[model samples]
Target: MATVRTLRISLVCLFCLMFIAGFAYRSLRMTLHSASSGFYLLHSAPHNNSSPASMELELQDLMKVIEWPEPPGPIDYNFSTSPFKTEFHMPFPRATYYVGEYVEFLITARDHHGRLKTYGGDYFQAKLHSPKLKAGVTGSVTDHRNGTYTASFLLLWPGQVEISIRLVHSSEAIAILKDKRETRPDKVYFYGFFDGTNETMECNVELAGPDICKYLDAQTGESWFCKKPKQIPCNAYKGHSAGQSQDILTQKEASFLNKSVKEKLISSKVGTFMVSPKNNTNDRGICSSGLPNPNPSGFYYQDFWQSRVCRNRAFPTPSNVTKCLSGKIIYMFGDSTTYQWWNFLLDLIPSLQRQELHMKYPAPQLAIDPENEFAVQWQAHQRPLTMKYSDKEELHYIANELDRIGGAKEGLVIVINCMAHFISLPIRFYIKRLRSIRESVLRLIKRSPLAKVSIKSGNTGYLYIHGSDWLSLQLDTVMRAMFSGLPVTILDAWQMTSCHYEPHHLHPGPVIVKNEIDLMLSFICPK
Candidate 1:
């Protein structure tokens, strides 16, 4: 009985040992398998290595290289020095050369999975990069399904030129990308009088911009006649002597009246007429005398009457002029020159009403006629006392007023002309004020979606005070710095009126004012 019991105990121990050994072997195998497969032993299967979280790839892998065009001459168009390439993928290369030149580039890229992919395209854009060069050229290739891109560029000038190229690529993931590129070519050319032909003279006198022409006309005291047939001068007055007489009325003074009648007749042909009668004794006689004694031996006065009468044939009146600003809100800011613009606009369009906003000290409010078709509001925030007192306080007041006006929700055409006031100040201080004003204006425009900001560079024609020409120069320099990045249309009034000035002060006369207004309007309503 004792031996049988011992045997049973031994068998139980062996079974226990076998079960322990089996469990140990399975655990060892699982640990080795988990290490090799990069999976946790506690988990059933290996984690996906292709998942975004598991892969450590950069954006460069997905980007493709762009091939650039070759240089025109023996010049070394070094594009390898540019820091535009990606670590993992190649960059889209761009180059600027002449029109008939060939451009070659290599684009090399590798995917995250260690697979290579290549793509290329060619194209060019036309844009002028130099004032001397008249035209520009560029070309590119599209439809890259065939795996090749051919680009070409050509320089118009034969002289020394500088060219810049840019390469760009966009990618959101590995092996997926888009590329875009641009280039600018600058060429040197000489421009001067070619010949004395009428076309060449016309081209030479051709205005840099309409503003320069209008300003010249205005400075020369010419009228800005609107285009209306009824307002135009009669054709008969084109070659008619200013001292000529007419038989329309029977009065000794009728000859003088004919002079006026002649003016009226000429005025009827062209909608507008410039009245700058020359100073001469004949002009007085045309106004005073009626009829001149006819001479049979020398000149036949009756023979001239027939042609004059034929030329005086009248035409039907034309339609009324079209209104420029129907319901638009045109806002003018700055000093007297701005006021000149406001007045010119008001004189041209009766629909415009002159309004004022008085901001006394801390608070400011805008006042305007709601029923008026157009309102010309002027805010001349000049602190004459601030020159002797605290300029900062004055600037604060100006900024507050600008903020209030700029925040208006209406469709606004804001014209700004400011540098004249702060020209005398130190450059730093002037820049500070300009920056503040710019920021305030920008904030206002950003707040108002319908605002179109037009900035007039301070008028050089007029100085703020006597002996302030230096101030105007400083003001321009400061303005250029302040408006570097802002999307403000700069109206160069100073350069426009560089040739002329008012009698004693720098203020431009009515003609310059009109021309400046026309120039401003051209930008406001471009043709």
Candidate 2:
């Protein structure tokens, strides 16, 4: 009996040890696996099924993903369908219409295959420019996903309004644009700073290496990490060339709007009032101050931009502009668009001569018209700037720069735009930055009520896929909403640039620059 009891106790001890060993083995495996792997987050929404209820659910989900989703896709459909040409014909051709009547038509496209591209994703630009009436009105194009699309316009100006269409980009080209933005870092311009008085070093995007110039400004406490330039004191600096500009997909490309699109003109009178095409006398949203037309004021052409506001235009002539700007001090803070605006003003007003200021980087691109006591200066904002500017020590935060300006004098014009550079960053950064700007502006107004402040709206061109246009528009919306609550005037460049037929760009054509400047003058000396 004693021998049997001893044998059973020995077996029990062995089983207890095995259980503890199994538990510990599992714990060890879990720790080792976690250490060897990485974790990431992803966001997605699904869509597009036939049933009505399901369709609604799908759309709801998609809207949550992209407020405006692209035309329902083969989401990966080949852009090679290649739109060759587009034709616009009034469904039941109308001879004329009353003022403000909507004119609609069907635009058909045939691809390189000469097949009516049943799957729609082609980009087409349409315009209603009547040189005879001095009008250039932009119209909208809607794709039906059936190769047929809709073009609509409201006839605000009564004249021989002619229609024209051009193919901008095929859906395929846009796809390429979308891919490049995500897969490549080339489109973005980056900056970094070095420490301990690195005399031979400067921030350059051209370099490629593992070691980046990581810097933090001691005074402002701003931190930045930049890619190294080609040659560096830190042996690791190598620069990457700035991204290439998007090649404008024109007719010269494999596909374009078919050459058969004929110009259509509306020569009839609007509501029995026969108006002269030479001058668009109609007014709807025109204000005496020449603020942007609140209503759809078709297009008005007078060589210079004609706002819907009544003809009480400010600075109607070059000399008129000079007189209006006399004795004013202007400060500009922005990217290249604002830079171009400064250049335009310099050229238009000859008396404003470029001064030989010794300070190079942040000296403020200044021009002085001593004869008129007018001075305008443009300082490229700190980093993420489009050009390869030398990052100088004097570079100050925009808000700090604004705070430093002394009590503002009457006739002080401040033009500011912060779009192109900030596009690549997360939207939160932009929102926080603008909120800070709003506070600064409010303080400025508190100190000097007579000083003028203007915020330049973002232009349309950058696509959502490329962190521009659709994406930039969102930021623009935030900017407008923030400033709208403030007392400053907003120069509505978005509508002016978006509505016209020009290829959208960071630097718009000379015509756009002129219109923008003229509008500025209107606010400075509102008639």
Candidate 3:
């Protein structure tokens, strides 16, 4: 009897030990998997490490996963003689789609003689608008090259969503599609100090002397210029112009927008308004509750996601703004368009105190609001940038800058956009830069799951010939796809800047900039 009792006790103890061991093993495994998910998603299954050169070769091979839209090749027909006439056909005409369903359409181009142009090199801005909802979403444009193109969209809400289409790129993209020239914009935006006062100027300054470039005369002074001294380079303070705005909508353009004349708007039914409080999954905030542009004027906030915080309010009050940005750290890297976003935030939220850093004028602007406990940093990418930056700013790269900050726990938000400068280079160069940042971002989120990432999509700026809006927008799509796998939220600035009554300006004016910042704020504080 004693021996039997002893065996029973031993068995019970062994069973309890095994159960605890299993639970602990499971717990550790879950933790590790969660930490490494982003890395594995970006990288591949674990295998034997390769040589450094081999590893780079592997990265190059794997990074080829993102399929970039091929720039249009030389077509058999001449665009000058046979300009394209736009037409969009929905995949399911007169159908109602539910939230999260993909909305796709086919766009075909007809030539001057009213014939289907059998070659594709056109770029169109595809958007969904719900005036009542104040929500908009930009669709993907795929050039089929056989004259027809595909515009794809994801239905983000349920309601009466309207489909508005605009031909952002005229037939010009076809000619410059291959041998893109280096035509820069003529409009000059620069900020400089003559003696005491510093201000933003639209400088088209004349050369007064070898050393003195005359900016604005005290009387005729609407703009400012660097007082030319041989030492002071007049062009040094000059900002890169993205070319002039498309002044008047062409007869074809007018036909495309006005239904009575040529174009017609379509209404789509998104079955219901069913946006969650916040979807941290893709970091797309409350998209369901968006209020589309009431006047439905100009390109407004329209993306896969809508702003949770700005549905009813243009911007948070000074007192509440700090609260919205509390405990956040923002990193902005790109050209002036991106810097405009950073500047907008700094100017709008007065409570968010900025600590002046003695860095170059525009490049390394750093500010921290102690009250809100949020920090913002802007770093310019390596040169080919239009604006003349300080020597200190030239050494910066997005990947290295991100490394310097290390990882953050729900505190870091990185915004990357360098498309304007990259227009002259081949798409492959842009792809390489994007892949490098992608790997770094993957490693970052792997170490810190709570960190947030954002990409500002490039738009159809008024770069007439040298830079093709169609090409730029296509590159933007590639960038979006590259970061699609990671936990990044795209701002979809392309549609925001395009589709507006306003000219396709590279540096969008105040109203557009305001909307851009509001959308970003919504992402940071999706209440």
TM-scores, in order shown? Answer: 0.35, 0.65, 0.57
Candidate 3, residues 117-189, lDDT tens digits: the string is 6555555667765666566666667888776778776665555666666665434333443333223222222
- Each prediction's RMSD over C-alphas, in Å, is 39.6, 21.8, 17.2
- Give the residue spans of candidate 3 off by over 4 A: 1-108, 128-164, 168-172, 181-315, 392-394, 407-410, 446-449, 462-465, 499-503
Clashes of 1: 39
The candidates, ranked best first by TM-score, are 2, 3, 1
What C-alpha lDDT, on a 0 to 100 scale, does residue 196 get in candidate 3?
A: 26
Q: Tens-digit lDDT track for model 2 on 1-527?
A: 55744543443333234323433553353334321111100101111113556535644443354332233443322334443344556676555465567676677766555556666665665666666545666677788878777877766666566666655555554454444433444445443333333433334323355745543322222334455444443323222112333433344331322222211121212222232323334544333221443433335465456665444354545588778877677789887788888888777777778766554544356676756656677876655454553433324446545655557546667888887666655544565456556666777777887878888888866543244454565567667666654667777777677666466666789877878887777777775
Q: Which candidate is the best by lDDT?
A: 2
Q: Predictions ranked by lDDT, top down?
A: 2, 3, 1
In angstroms, give how far residue 367 of model 2 lies from its true place.
2.3
For model 2, how many clashes? 18
lDDT for each of the candidates? Answer: 0.33, 0.55, 0.52
State the lDDT at 517 in candidate 3: 69
Question: Whose TM-score is greatest here?
Answer: 2
